[model samples]
Target: MIDIFLVPIALVVVLVMLHAWFGVGILKRGIIFTDLAIAQFAALGSAISLGYFHEEYFYILTLSFALLSAFLIAIASQREIKLEAFIGLLYVLGASGIMMVLSHSAEGMEHFKSLLASDILFTSPNDLYKSAIIYAFIALALWKILPKTKGFVRELLFFSLLALTVTSSVQLAGVLVVFVLLIAPAFVAISLELKKPLLYSFFFGWFFSIVAIIASYYFDLPTGYSIVFLGALLSSTIVLFSSKKNSAQN
Candidate 1:
């Protein structure tokens, strides 16, 4: 049992550390739905592969669609239009397109459900290793390259990296899990005005994710959805109560 859970736990740790960093940046930009939109597009690409190509070009299709959305979002970030709303539209378009693409497949519903949230409890060690390598490169870029960029180039690099992260994460975890992991911890840390929000975000994310993993193991629940549920619930609850307390004092 311990050996079986080792890879999954390591995956959770790597995911939290990488995602919490991006989550802070996303919240600061105020484009909260960016991950969801890009993730939806990634999912659309995966759906296309599953529906038509039998998942042959899964990574290429997923990254291509994710990069396309990131490119558009990067452009929108430079423009004066409603960015969040535009991202929302992109999300819905990708979502509807996925349903349409999968409509005729015999296992469409199963695929759709899995796309929303996969059972990460059984995640393979190979998958964990691949994701960790991908995330390490992304982390390096974020640390070394991203800070030097500016204006449109900066936005493009940021969103492109996000797309890359989401592309890998959505495949390993799922769209919802990716979104929650990318947002919830950062949301809480930012809301509470932590001095070291990134570090706290990592801590908060790991706490909930690891707890969710343990609970799922004992209860036989869906591991991905359990993480999503606990992360969202705990983060939101903490933020809300903290906000109310601050408001009452003021």
Candidate 2:
């Protein structure tokens, strides 16, 4: 039983570490839905692959779409238009594209649900290994290369790396899982004004993820949904109590 969970747990740990860092950047940039949009595009690409080509080179298609979305967003960020609105449009476009692509398929609904919240409990070892490698490379770029860039170049690199991360993560977890992991813990850490926000975010994310995984095993709940539920629950509780504390102080 313990052995069975080792791989999944390891995968979640890696996800928390990398995602928490990216979450900090996203929160700071105030582009909260960026990950969701990118993940949706990635899923749309996968849906296209499955609906038409039967899953051949699905990752390549997904990564390509994600990168394209990233590039568009990067360019748009330099303009004076409402960037959030543009991101929202991209999200809707990707979502509707996925539906249209999968409309005639018998497994459309199942594929849609999997894209939203995958069965991480059954993730293959190969997927986990590939995801780890991708995340590690992104982490290295963020730590070394990102800090040296400025303005448009920095924004482009950031979004490009984020898109790649979302592409891999959506395959391992799901779009909803990726969004929650990218936002909730980071939100909580920022709300509480932690000095080491990224470290705290990692702890919060890891704790909830582990709890959700164990709860899913005992309750037969969907692992991805369970993680999202627990993450939202914890973050909301923190926000509620923190607001109350502030009100009392005032």
Candidate 3:
């Protein structure tokens, strides 16, 4: 039992650390759906590969679609128009595109379900190692490169690195899992106004995620969706109840 779970837990630890950082940035930007939209596009690329190309150029197509969305969002961030709406549209577009692309495949629905949230309980060690390597580079870029840059170039780099991260994570953990990991912990940290929000996010994310993994194993539930459900539920509950209520004074 311990051996089976160690790799997945390690994967989530790495994922939470990297994603919590990006989540802070996303909350500040007010474009909450950016990760989902990019992740959807990445999944669309994978769908295309699975449907037509039989999984050829999987990484290239996935990264291409993800980068395309990031590029568009970077350009849109510079504009005066509504940005979240644009991202929402991109999400629907990618989602619809995925369905259309996978329409003819025999395993279409299964593919769609997995794209939304993979069964990460059985994720292999090799997958974790590759993603860890990719995430290390991304973390370095976020810490060193992102702060020193300015203007559209900075925007592009940030989103590009996010895209790169999502490209691998979407494959490993699926889209909804990526979204929750990116948003849930950071949302909690921000909502509570923690001094060390990033550190808090890491702790909070790891707690819910590991618990979800354990719960899924015992309950025979889907691991990825379990994480998403528990994370969303806890984050929302905590934020709502812990919120300051209005009081009237005489």
Best of the candidates, lDDT: 3
The pairs that clash in candidate 1 are none
lDDT of 2 by residue, 28-133 (tens): 9888888999999999999999999999989899999999999999998899999899999999999999999999999998999999998788778888888888
Tens-place lDDT per residue, model 3, 152-210, is 99999999999999999999999999999999999999999999999999999999999
Instruction: Write down the lDDT that model 1 would get.
Output: 0.94
Q: TM-score of the candidate numbered 3? A: 0.97
lDDT of 1 by residue, 1-250 (tens): 7886788889989999988888999999999999999999999999999999999999999999999999999999999999999999999999999999999999999999999999888999899988989998999999899999999999999999999999999998999999999999999999999999999998999999999998999998999999999999998889888885557667
The candidate, 1 or 3, that scores higher on lDDT is 3
- Give all candidates' CA lDDT scores: 0.94, 0.92, 0.96
Model 1 clash tally, residue pairs: 0
Displacement of residue 25 (Cα, Å) in model 1 is: 0.5
TM-score of each: 0.97, 0.96, 0.97
Clash pairs detected, candidate 2:
none
Cα-lDDT of candidate 3: 0.96
TM-score preference between candidates 2 and 3, better one: 3
- Candidate 3: list runs displaced more than 4 Å: 246-250
Candidates 2 and 3, the one with greater lDDT: 3
